[model samples]
Target chain A: MDRRDFLRLGSAAFTTATFFPQLSFAGTLPHGWLNGFKDNQGRYGVAYIDQKLQAEVLFHTPLRLHGIYKHPTRDLIVAPARRPDTELYVFDVTTKSIKVITADEGRHFYGHGQFNQDGTLYFTTENAYDEERGMVGVYDVTQGFKRIAEWSSGGIGPHQMRLYKNRLIIANGGILTHPDTGRATLNMDDMAPNLTYIDITTGQITQQFSLSEDLQHLSIRHIDVDDNGIVYMGLQDQVKNRRDLPLVWKTNGDTLDMMDEPVEGWEIFNGYIGSVSTNTHGLCVASPRGGCAHIWDQTGTTYIKQKDVCGVSKNADGSFILTSGEGIVRDLDGQNQRHALHFDNHCQAV
Target chain B: MKRFFLFSFLLLSPIAVQAAPSMQEMSLKVTEEFILPAYDDFAKQAHAQSELWGETCDAEKLKPAFQKTSDAWAKVQHINFGPITSLLRRDRLYHWPERRNSISKSINKSLADKDPASLDLDKFASTSVALQGLPALERLLYSDGLLDGDFACKLGHTIALNIEKIATGTDKDWQEALVNIKEGIAHPIYFESMDEVAIRFFTEMLAGFQMITDQKIALPLSSSLKKANGKRAEGWRSNRSTRYIQQNSLALMAMAKPFMSFMPDDVEKQVVAQFTVFARAANALPLSIKDGVKDEEGRAKIKKFLDETRTTRNLLVQTFTKHLGLTVGFNSLDGD
Candidate 1:
């Protein structure tokens, strides 16, 4: 009937299902809980569920969200709009209130952002659509999320960037699609999608690596970092001639190694991968299109299939918690939890 | 306080009940009118095709039945989520948008080895799905390699029979599923509420448009007309890309009809007009969508049609649903 009543209903619905087996782990649990959107009835907003699976808070958004970023030093969460969207919502988890912000003129969110250390600055990948460029918007978080500067993401259609120390590792999905044409990749044959490492302070591209000539069609879209600081990237292959191309790659600052999977195993992915995350064991990648999630060990080898799952994030001890669009959540061992909500493609531990 | 709350709920109950019947009627009519009948037609045509294949292994005899079955499939392919998804029946029916010619490769290997298992209808169930669907049948019937008395024709006959079996079985499944859905709606579990059922229907319809827009057209069109690639079109192997999309638009238009009463009258007209424009442009395209992509005028026409279909999809997804007082919370097509 009202905010308190709806919250009570949500909490009772979520926490009453306590019959699930205890999810065993080997190390200290993550400090904070999981945060993602609780989408239902075509209405969506941020949702926070604690370690005990207690529903903490829920807030509504007028537009769809992409990834969630926790403030470096506060109880705030920042979620950007899905690409071609011009809005962003900053939710203060403590107060359960949100502040909406608009991207500057001629720019729109590429759906991901991360705060620099100490939460002083926020950087997001954006489309300089009119300029045919991929630019990163730098916000002075202390100055009320001010747009202080902009930098090239080092390629076109940049999506999913992360902070590695002081540098930014960006997966510049090379396919150029205009918001006007609506998600159609303007350049497939001649388009170049690359992974770039940039110096965040100066907005300079420190290093960039393009896929080999034969693998140019693989748009490196999502990325995650292993405990060892190696960046593992997942690709959505755009070429129709080949579906067996490797969909997972790992990088150590300079070079990229295409991880191998059995031909049949790769076929299960159907050439589209949605998200990637890393844990102590290895990297976890999701293919929502293929309805499969895969794991590759730290060596960047040894592929394993966990069928019919997606929306993966790491637990404190480095095991994976997976969610599905069907509203089921479970860990690697399959201790299941259910709620009346659709889990979007991204989830993370704050 | 409790007494007052109870009184208010009682006062509002009739109004809530009054809103549900129209939603129920819409869902029921769609299942009864469009979805069930299309799957039924698919089953009947597939059975006829199998019978023709059995009567004569001749491709000429089999071709007409094959096309009829394919057209039937296109009409109902929008049901990609429910009963047909069971046992990979949908993929087994037509593995278009195939990977690296796997269908041809699997078929070729089976034929080359003269795999006795290929002739066994039951054994074909466990075979790679690539060899089991309409695509395989189209290949065996229309490709030049198959002779009337050849082993490949025997395999083709077995596949045809298998497709018939799946189609018939799927139709039965749909009937049973509809029964369960109706029961669930009345009881509110298979779907949480009547609103959910309506939302699910709209979402599926939206998903159908997404498949046409993303996989069928945009994937091939790439960024521009100059860079078009026809190989990405669905049903490229059969050269039925445009035909397939035409059937899809027709089916989608039919689906929108029952929901028209729920929408503003002009919205209905606008939605239908858009579909009609796209369908005309789609049907008028040259022999194959791939070939169409190679010609400047043809590409322009195809692009215009795709843009129109996208607009129609947006209306159904955003405006139509909102007007119907439904919400689609999320679309898988809206990726990160």
Candidate 2:
């Protein structure tokens, strides 16, 4: 659909009395945005929002999902349960059928995964909790999503991964946690977070970059890459009351460089960054803790003020679309809509 | 026609509405009545303790002052936002649940150093947080041979002075935060609205409860009798664990009073009754947290207190946010 058609549909939907207006042209929309949410009645579901901004709940489950991924060449979408959760939900958009994939024994999903260029293989960052190490669980998409192999993630607490060229760029959060202790970080004092690039063909780590000694407690948790191949990372600080620390960094060729703190200071983020996305505008990093999203570009940095804002993704026109826990969908162009759902951390333009 | 007109009039009639407390009013009440006072008390007690230590290293005179300072901290520790969170001051003031013997190792290193510059206040301020807080002070006062030498006494005095500096800075910072909160939308960084202020306060309050239940209580009260480790309790070395819990419960109750006017009458009643039961249980604890976790009879009492606290926390979570028309978001509360 073109921009004009999208605007027309948006206007028609805006006049409806209910919060979510059903669009007749939803099926005709080419692309959709997928996210996890909890409804007003406290039901967990994955929502699919089409090009015309019509949203539909694909399926409901007991697990609270985090990151979502759409198969590169298929109608399948996978939503992984957050860390320490063992379930991964696979939904086929065309057939409206769902498949539940369970993590291997003694391992759990870290809530993020990526598909290979041809879409034949799927890899998910996982925790080998019993062994106190991180692993990348590989699935053979051609063979009914079988768990074919596992590779060392090169560090502890491997979260969010991205496929760049022939390598998988993984954020090793470095914080140690176990299912027995819930989500508490067991090794904050000695955490050494890093960004690891693994060669997909060899299953070996090709390059890894870590922060300086002073920044050992900064857990690199989320990642996004701009069009120019600059990798942006969102960080979470394990130590409290250290608001002077930077929460965003970008890869500079072979090393990691901390981004300049905004004029307003790093305290505004409250020491956590939930999701990171890139668009024509720049790198958009969301901090649900600070209730805002910041766009960092070559010119400077600008922020959008929204309560509990986390999920962010790029629109076709190069603008950014943001979702919040208050059930609000917003864009940089000032279009706003609310639904009876509380959006989770990450959203993907499927 | 007359009956029809009367029915329409009744349908559109204005009903009497009970005005819920405004965000501005709630913020003012909480800040002025609870937060500021607690910070002031903490600063005062810390200053007194520092002065007493400076005058004499006598344990008998210094111990009571240390208790007063700790009690004041327990009252204000729940207010974890704003100025207190600026410079790692909170951890520097009382780093607890110490890991890998960090405190003792730092202390031993400091004690072995012969240079006079080692005991300098400016240099000590830059030391590991483990050696700059109440836990270190507790070790100095309660441990057997730590405070025998002049260097150890000087070290103790330096730590006390460091804590007082943090306490004073925090108190001053909160004064500025109060102005920002009162400014509401006018303030540049503190808060955007009164609702935002209330949400932050409520979230921190819930976090304080979780900390107490998870670390202060559950860590010491292990799963089974054989696994019980009394040393795990906060302030166990000073034998002030039970007293700290009591102070914390009382402080939380005091902080909660401002929100009562916003709740429905039935909810308010239930909350008050639950808090009463929780406070009474905290007060009735018969032994220190160290002994309570290890002894069978004392363990039962501590367990009952823990259960009461959990029940009260649940009641607040279910009612307080709903009545306040506020949501502590899942993403904001527990995002990866």
Give the winner by DockQ: 2
How does residue B66 of candidate 2 score in lDDT?
A: 93
Q: Rate the local accuracy (lDDT) of all candidates.
A: 0.71, 0.80
Error of 2 at B202 (Å): 1.2
For A1-350, candidate 1 gives per-residue lDDT tens digits of 45465455445434221111112222232354444544444445555444544332245566666788888778777888877888877766555456778999988898799899889999999998878899999998888898999998999999999888888989999867667567766565456889888898788999888888657778999998755668888988764333456888888557888777744456567567888998888778877656567776655543344333457788776777776666556666646665555677777777
lDDT for A181 in candidate 2 is 49
Model 2 complex DockQ against the native: 0.27
Residue-level lDDT of model 2, residues B188-293, one tens digit each, is 5456678878887888787777666766776676554665678777787788989889999998888888787677888889999999999999988856888877
Name the DockQ score for candidate 1.
0.09
TM-score (chain B only), all candidates: 0.86, 0.89
Q: Candidate 2 lDDT, tens digit per residue, A1-350?
A: 34465345335433321112232333322586888887655557677766655456555667788888888988788877888889887776665567889999999999999999999999999999878899999999998789999999999999999988888989999977677545656565567889999999989999999988767778999999776767899999775535778999999999888888887788778889999998767788899888889988777988788889999999888778889998778878987777667888888997
**TM-score of model 2 relative to the true fold?**
0.84
Error of 1 at A121 (Å): 9.8
